[model samples]
Target: MVSISDYGDFYKMAKRNIMLAILGFNAQKHFCDTRERMVSNVLSSLHKLVAVDPHSPLNFREVYTTELFGLSLIQNLGEDVCSVYVEEFGREISKEEIFHVLVHEILSCVVEPDWRDYFPYLSWLPNKSFETIVSSTEFRRDAVMNALIKRQKERIARGEARISYIDFLLEAKNSTQLTDHQLMLLLAESIAAAVDTVLEWLYREIREVCGGKAVTEEDLPRLPYLDAVLHETLRLHSPVPVLPTRFVHDDTTLAGYDVPAGTQVMINVFGCHMDEEAWESPGEWSPERFLGEGFKLADRYKTLAFGAGRRTCAGSQQAVSIACVAIARFVQELQWTLREGDGDKEDTMQYTALKLHPLHVHLKPRGS
Candidate 1:
């Protein structure tokens, strides 16, 4: 029941150290070296879905893409960072388990209100129902995480000699003064946190740019329009609609009238992205606004979808790379059109923004 401010310097230090390990140049290069295999596996899984009956409509919803994306991401992250292998799609039970624990169990608990948060003095008051639910969810989450750590430890005992984030944590356990439970939570947070599109114009762009060859990571730099499409999409449908709460250490005025030292603040990410003052016709889906010479890769952060500053997403660059390559490859191989009824569903938010209803779409091979 610790409040947001309860985290101490050691916690922050451990997180900083872990983030540096995961996001450093060599770690990023490892991710890059494995990108081709990851993308290939995803595309292969996708092909399986649409290739069935070839002309039939596919649901092509978030769940489907999530599977493709999650499996690929977990496979790379697990292999490179955890020394574990997540099965490919179809046999991707591990990926599904990870998502279930992360999105359903943990995220559900996150949005649940706790009486203690608003009234610390009432912390002793009985909260049996909430406590029961949270406890159950935590048990389930810890089960999954503990299993991964246990497997990693066995690898270490076997003298596998693999370098991974988990190995780093294990080695630093004594130096960091991190208890087993603390290490488990740190690994859980890392695993949980370590967790499209305009078609028509982009199809033409790919055809012109790649000339019928598949889009590769190298070609991403040349696809500025594709970059705009991604930026606009992120602006409209941010990764997280409301970021985690922040604790104010000193009194300060914010937006005219906020002056309290102990106040807890939260950013309404969706509101900021849709701010009329900042973006022209903010509700409109206009990729062209991001085009021309003003466009820079750094501009992708302008929406703050991945957060801003040092606390920004550690996997942001890796995220962009995977997304650009995936989108390009999809358009290069298939024709995509939204199903009639799905075109109007508003985006919904849980922990991340998602469609109120799953997106349904029709797809066909390009030559067909």
Candidate 2:
């Protein structure tokens, strides 16, 4: 196993690269184009509909599962039906849940073509032929892109101002030599990483505040206790528990041990998160250890929840913002209670190769 230090290095590298991409995307010259404006308008409209319609049944899970299942609901259903679908499921609302939802959306929008071709098994699982899935997804994507492009052209004709990611990408297409697959891969990685990490942090923090009356913006500054809880949860249960495999290009020595070049290195982030040397009472949930004078507890990058080094998550700002907004909204708008007679049960956590998520929890609206 690679040492914790090595893991930290890779995490930081990953974070840096991802952040650069986010910065590139957010650059005024890139995002403020005509195409982006059109896309943003549609997204804003959707967000508004979700916010205003209290009876709307939609939530993060419904959106995510629909995308993952390749259902036509997203394509055909109106906002009201979407809301009803989510309400019927009564799923737990959390930052992590939203992350998965966003992942599916981003994948559907940007990665469908190459992804289906690269992973043919995805088509089989969805009960669709590879060619069929590819053709359909491609057609849908193109239609959306064309619509946005047309909107941009109309705005330009009307002398209206506009901005969008599509415009930046189209411009970049003329200047860069990136293949469609390469572009899609970059987009997939960004969406997946952003959504997953943000949601993980959100769920852990919200759970800490569960006993409180509600979470509010006024409570934001005084959330040291809650912050501690988030820290402890992350330390105990990192979402991405396994670092990506790294290949040594040349021979190296570590901690006085010689290793051959070209070896595959795997860092156990889960192990480091629970390492006794790095944490006191590593398994316990203690938020106090992360606050005030104890803030140094996180200085070592010992908690590799965000990874370390050059590859640290790039979308950390956006991810954190999304989590904060969602959590704030949940705390301000809803009251919750653990399912009857099951209040004492611990969270059922599950893991996969890429992420960890809460299995289930029964919570009812507090005021309902």
Candidate 3:
């Protein structure tokens, strides 16, 4: 189990690198002209969607993921590279895939872009029926890495130093020795685990907010109700409902029972979150419970969204920031209603290990 403190550095590094990438993308004049301009365009588009009609059909997740991914790529690779990359890969990009790619890029910037340098095993093609697809992916990734490395080398040779994620990783004077394969595995693991978990929370919050009145920048500060809703949703439907199993280091007594060392303990976080003793109307969707003195649904330590001890999530802050921004923008832009004849309640109450989303609903333009 990793504690929050242990992961603080990781969180800081991810946040810094991701933001830098966003800024870099926006600074490109050929495509965006200015960061503010690009942001304004997106914001304006969102507002237009919101004002046009309360029931217009809009895929919030699709638009949000595309924009976010586009921004990240623009920052890290510039307009030309981002354009080519998207043209080649965008059609294949699902929400989960976008999250995976973004997480990998961010992690590489912070830790080691040449992580595969240590783990050569990852570069080898495995003997599998889908080897062709796997090999193609590997080739594409290697091409990107080679391009980045060449750029760095050119800067060095020209006596012009550049500060980039890759540059920082290369400059780590004291680093643990890891094989190229291990480094690739580490990078892959970070991306796969972090992205989907964060997206699940993000999608849930955005859906909830978009279910109500339009949300705008002016309404941001006053949206405690929205914040409360997000908090309550997270508490009720944690992405990873089952905490990782912990092995006991020593024999101990628990609830008057003796347990031997080496025993594995599993905590049902989902069950605890819904315990009648812990929360009132445990199964209902009430954001009010998370506000002010009523915010006692569960103990902070017991909230297993971030886990506990040494193994807690390392990207909590980044995840929250992404979710908050996406949700706010979505609410500000789109107006929606339950499908006709479906009653007044939301039908997106189901949960799965993958994600939680609303059922099909028709939305027409508010005025048209």
Candidate 4:
């Protein structure tokens, strides 16, 4: 029974930023009202997209995640609708720029080869190909994100009430000294993380659980399997495999290794998750292993998809809610299968992430 009203910071963030980001500040209630309703519409859109291409092998996975899911998240963050209201795209800029960031910036940065990562002293050595890709990704990401922020500014200036997470960030700027760059990056990452992980979530497991019937939020309580599947998804294919860099506060020893203060450490979360000492059959997707374990998923909860410690995702609850809605509705509506003859093709592991490469699926309408 987590009421939206219970989130006090949400109210404060919206209140402070709404006037600068948008006009007329009674947007808190509007945000709460649309939170669930927007998801319902998104679910409807996904079904419609699948319906349009039935009987043919379709890349419904790509369409749902890249087009529908990304669009839906943008709308939730602070837009009138999924349609890009502002005519900001040019020949140089892509309409799907955010998707480009997910694929190129985040995914490519992690998966691609770069010896500099191992030997920090060789960082100046050239990697022309990846550097070019990164340049393009950054340009597009910044352009699109800036345009979005500008649109919100215009909407608020005209006194149109638009309550969104971006507005919350605006509100925090005055009190918390949150910079505009920080705000836009926050919104951008939120879109990327929310859409990408749900795209890679265990759809097959979900299909098995829901049985081709659309799963409403009400039905979620009865479907513990959905939760377990999500848990296993994080365990096996954590979206953020390597954590952000961290610094040691004081000299210490860990696992019999000595560490000194001022050392910059990059934790290998993926390696920890796959270690055999903690997980039995660590490579396999096994949701049932968590059952009857009484929440002892592991001694230390090695999963680090959203990160760990005090810097763990602030919007974790909201992210999980979105994931649940997407998974339940998706599993309920479509009969999904891997593309023919590609059953043996496992998810591809990139330097930064592990996900299905060009995910293609044959989606048949449930009950048809």
Q: Give the per-residue lDDT of model 4 (tens digit) for 161-185.
A: 5556675666556876767776776
Question: TM-score, each model?
Answer: 0.84, 0.52, 0.54, 0.72
The model with the greatest lDDT is 1
Lowest summed lDDT over 10 consecutive residues: which window, candidate 4? Answer: 1-10
Q: lDDT for each of the candidates? A: 0.70, 0.44, 0.47, 0.59
Tell me, by TM-score, which candidate is best.
1
What is the lDDT, from 0 to 100, of the residue 79 in candidate 1? 48
Q: Judged by lDDT against the true structure, how good is candidate 1?
A: 0.70
Summarize candidate 1's per-residue lDDT along 177-202 as a digit string, tens digits: 87889878766665555203467788
**Model with the higher lDDT, candidate 1 or 4:** 1
Which digits, one per residue and each the tens of the lDDT, describe model 2 over residues 46-150? Answer: 355555664443343333333322211111110111221123234433333333343444444432334444565674555355457656655533333233244
lDDT of 3 by residue, 1-368 (tens): 12211245654554344334332233222233332333445556655665576455554445444555554433333321332223444343343444544344433333222334346668574445345445565554544444434555565567665443333333441363434443333333333341223334434554465555444333434556556656666777676666655667789999898989967676777888888997787887666676778565455555677676646565454444445544555334433444554433332221213233433334333234
TM-score pick, better of 3 and 4? 4
